[model samples]
Target: MPATSSTTEFSRTGNGSSSASTKDIEVQLQQLREDISALAKTVAAVGNEKATEVKGKAKRAAADATDASYQMVEAAKSQAVSLERDLERQIRANPIQSVAIAAGAGFLFALLSRR
Candidate 1:
């Protein structure tokens, strides 16, 4: 009787090494390519999400600035109206005194204009 040796179909060079199979190497390479593609998609998704978040923050800031500006303008207009009303009331209460003040101001303007 002769002794027998066991070998697998993928074990070439008679070394029982399945790692030498071209089919196995190609399969691993294909899996690596797929993993890289998935990683790229994930990175792109994260980038897009960050961009959207920043855009939203910028829009909110702009809206807040506009609201503040409108409030300030309204306040200035209210102050101007209040001052005008006070002046009108003063003129009405002392008509003769207002006339004297106006005459004095006119004389000063005339003197200054002569220069």
Candidate 2:
């Protein structure tokens, strides 16, 4: 009878320890979930910060490209004006030869158009 009572007590103590262990495991699992959630938020914030920086860089690059394109267009216009002035000076210096060359070009165009 004494042994039976001792065995019963041991089983009761084991049940208590088992319940306590289960609670401890549950608490640990909850803590891990919270830690993971916090880490996810941190990652998202870093990603957003990086995205903003990239957007700023892209805007700056676009502005630079636009400025370069404008500069090229202005240079082309300046070159075209310079060439027109040179052509006018040449025509004025050799009016007779210019007219003869114009007549020859016109004859060639007429022959080509007939074909």
- For each of the candidates, the C-alpha root-mean-square deviation to the true structure, in angstroms, is 6.1, 2.1
Give me candidate 1's TM-score against the actual structure: 0.59
Measured against the true structure, the TM-scores of the candidates, in listed sequence, are 0.59, 0.83
Candidate 1 regions exceeding 4 Å error are: 1-26, 94-115
lDDT of 2 by residue, 38-79 (tens): 999999999999999999999999999999999999999999
What lDDT, from 0 to 1, does candidate 2 have?
0.99
In terms of lDDT, the poorest run of 10 residues in model 1 is: 1-10
Model 2 TM-score (2 dp): 0.83
Which residue runs does candidate 2 get wrong by more than 4 Å?
109-115
Per-residue error (Å), model 2, residue 72? 0.7
Candidate 1's residue-wise lDDT over 77-100, tens digit each?
999999999999999999999999
| Cα lDDT listed for each candidate | 0.88, 0.99
